[model samples]
Target: MDTTDDARTRIDTTVAHPARRYNYWLGGKDHFAADRASGDAIAAAMPGVKLMAVENRAFMGRAVRYLAEQGIRQFLDIGTGIPAPNNTHEIAQSVDPSSRVVYVDNDPIVLTHARALLTSAPGGANAYIDGDLRDPEAILAHPDLPATLDLSRPVALLLVAVLHFIREDEHPERIIETLTAALAPGSYLVASHATWEYLPAEVIAALTRNNTDGRFQARTAARFAELLAPFDLVEPGIESVAYWHADDVPGPRPSAEEVACFGAVARIR
Candidate 1:
């Protein structure tokens, strides 16, 4: 549990942040007034925004469970937001008590909440790396990462709902390659990103503007495919967060209206 305590007071409550806003949308108590304001504005524009958050979390749990059941003992979850129930470590360790997880986030508030998310099983471990997704090397080289994870073994790397925050100009491919290539062949890469392919023109414009704080980068279908190219995609390929690995549990799925996210799970060679 390498949580950074030097950042609690440094967090600004002025501009909204993706992680804090997301926490607000998910009904978490760690968000600020600015986050709530931003989240409410986005929700007003897209009524399904909260639904997307919930579904994305469900997808995370399913993906972690799937990987753990496949015997993945280590996990690297980048862009981890405020502490929430059914976190990566919880889901994975429930399947196998020896599972170890390291969560990474750049948000200072998220770092403040890191300790709450670090509860681990007796035989397992959970740690947090206060770093950015753009700097995968720093995360990989962090002291707590290697202390809890075995790079030579299969690891499930989760980038769920966070890549959208990284603009395309950042060369997301190189980052993915660097992280995925460092893992064992049986390792898995699971991510969910926002896409314009599911939204209408007007809605896209408004949503894009809402994210104009230089935080998220909405991508297209083609670009999404390129990110998953480094690994062999699992069944059903990349699809809507609600459609990927969807179980037969209920009513009609979210309409094709304006989905800005797609999810996929792939394995390294």
Candidate 2:
């Protein structure tokens, strides 16, 4: 299907999408009734889900800011969910106004709203692609990606809270290695993923039952760590999402149970 047709067919408001459900968690208005229902169901089961989403967003901001501070200006954010406040481009450009970002996602609904994340400072650039993380080459070779980001230079590759959708059969580690190998030396690979290891049995069962698409297969922290093995992890390696170089913002920090995701930033070298 063409872009518009693709969007119309793929965006099923009848069921909840991870992006839309996440938008619901973040209090964004871009979700449907089904999305809200599923999100609420998950929240009811896992009491700390809303806080987990919030902490994930905060971790994204901190990770991007740290990459920018390290003088990395180009970003390739895959599995970029619905546009939310303090997105990667927003955080990166805030630190370096000249930073460039190219966002990619498989969801057509996200593509429909991709323009929302494309706004950038005059000297910087932002672009979006209707692509999937399963197909890293398509993302890497997309015309817009090379047009906006200099892959030969250090770029930050973000895979936050999305890899769980990729099943073990998909060979996630090989996929990550392929993507990281393509980046220039000194480039950063950042990711956060959900885990059953941190959750209670009842909550985990409820979450698994509620996952409509069977897209997520929550793994152990050990499997999550293996995903980062190809790269050199930065300081505070593989900490809880909330504690990943967390800074005390004005608001209250989330509790340990509120952070079911693990986050890490690693260099391609």
Candidate 3:
């Protein structure tokens, strides 16, 4: 919310971008008309998408807290959308104030709002990288990352709700491998991906057709599991984003069919 005029200058509201569209789904005010249009189309195709956004957010909080409690004090959260409450660093710093975080996103709007994303608690550090996940090397070599996190120690690599935008043809797995390979052996991988395995055939067809122009590639549950090939999955394994380590939160449970996302946390060892 610390957006400035200079930051807003980089944004192009004429075209819909992933981060802005996602923000629109999460009921954030950081999006444009183009993003709202795309988000509305998806909601019309699948009414539960808003629920997926909410649950995916919850999963990120729980996973980050779990990692911090496990002594992971560094975080590399890629695909960090617009500034939101309880973000990666906020959750981690709440558990361990010394946590360091590097947030990366290609969206111009996100880069413009760097001030909000860069705020960190005392004893913690936060930095922003204007990079894309499609190019892992550039992000890995970014100067801001090394300044904030230690590659020699454990770091949590977050890819929540980002990979689906990269087509399977783009070799998303290879991109992930490139990033994880550079981390220390004790590093962790926390991810939440969109999956259409739970929808009916007709709904899936509609959703696919609606998103073809938008370039959203929703995968099945099994294929989603393969992305974690480099790491060992934690207890309870891959499940709906809403259900992963969510027993502590008091609320009426949402079914996997409603959430429509595959979420998991894995260890590099």
Candidate 4:
């Protein structure tokens, strides 16, 4: 990871970063004015945008917990946004104190706050790598990652709420393949991605037109599932993040339209 000054110099406060915007949506204080503007603009187009963010976050927590309960003690979480409550390591370590996790993110601001994500339990270990999801090879080769997680073991790969930012031209499927190829069989792929399938055509058009940063590219359920090729979807399949393993959540959950994201956990086959 870069030093604090190096990371700070790399950060462009003028532009809105996805991690910062997401932090703003989650009501965190790490975002700049640009992020708030971007978030507010999206919210104006889709009133339930905040709900989508919240539901997606909840899905990540549930997925991590489920993986931990299934005896997965190692996690590689990419696109780790600003450290929020019950982060990957926190949830996994809560299940098993000896759990180990490696978090990767591209945002320099996130790197500045990486210390928060590195706080592991007494028996567990956590590491943060300043890397991009678009470059799987680089992330996989990061020294901290290898030191924290053993690829030969059945580690869980968490891509929650981050794949949508990967444009089609970037070949997100290839990225998934590259990363999963490094993991051993029995490794789990847990992901939640934004989808346009639940939105009306007009709403989609409006949102698309309003998208100025071109940071988000919502995919359909089928497309998202395709990215998980060679991996079998766990029971319940790809469904709204609001409802995916959400039995423990309070009643009167938001509608699919309100939380327009598909989430699922799949296993390497």
Best by TM-score: 4
Off by over 4 Å in 2: 1-6
Worst window of 10 by summed lDDT in candidate 1: 1-10
Q: Estimate each model's TM-score.
A: 0.94, 0.94, 0.95, 0.97
Q: Candidate 3, residues 1-269: lDDT per residue as tens digits?
A: 54356567767898888899888988899998988988898788899999999999989999999999999999999999999999898999999888999999988888777888889999999999988999999999999889899899999999999989989888989999999999999899999899888888888888877775657888888888888876899988998898899888897879999999989999987
Better of 2 and 4 by TM-score: 4
lDDT string, candidate 4, 1-269, tens digits: 44877999999988988899999999899999998988898888788889988889999999999999999999999998999888999999899999999999999998888888888999899999989999999998888988988889999999988999999989888999999999999999999998887777788888898777676889988888788767899989888999989887977899998888899999997
Q: What pairs collide in candidate 2?
A: none
lDDT of 2 by residue, 1-269 (tens): 45756686778888778888899998999999998999889889987888888889989999999899999999999988989889888999899899999998877888777668888987899998988889887777789987898779998999999999899888898779778888899999999988778677787888889876788878777988888887889999988889888866666666666678889999899
**Error in Å for residue 267 of model 4:** 0.5
Model 4: what TM-score? 0.97
C-alpha RMSD of each candidate structure in angstroms: 1.8, 1.7, 2.2, 1.3
Estimate candidate 3's RMSD in Å: 2.2
| Cα-based lDDT at residue 212, candidate 4 | 72
- Best-first order by lDDT: 4, 3, 2, 1
lDDT string for model 1 (1-269, tens) is 33365676668888788888888878888888888989998888787888888878878888888888888889999999988889999998899988999999989988777777788998999998888989988888889988889989888999999888777678788888888878988889999987666667787788778876666787877888888987899988888877777776387777434445788999989
RMSD versus native structure for model 2 = 1.7
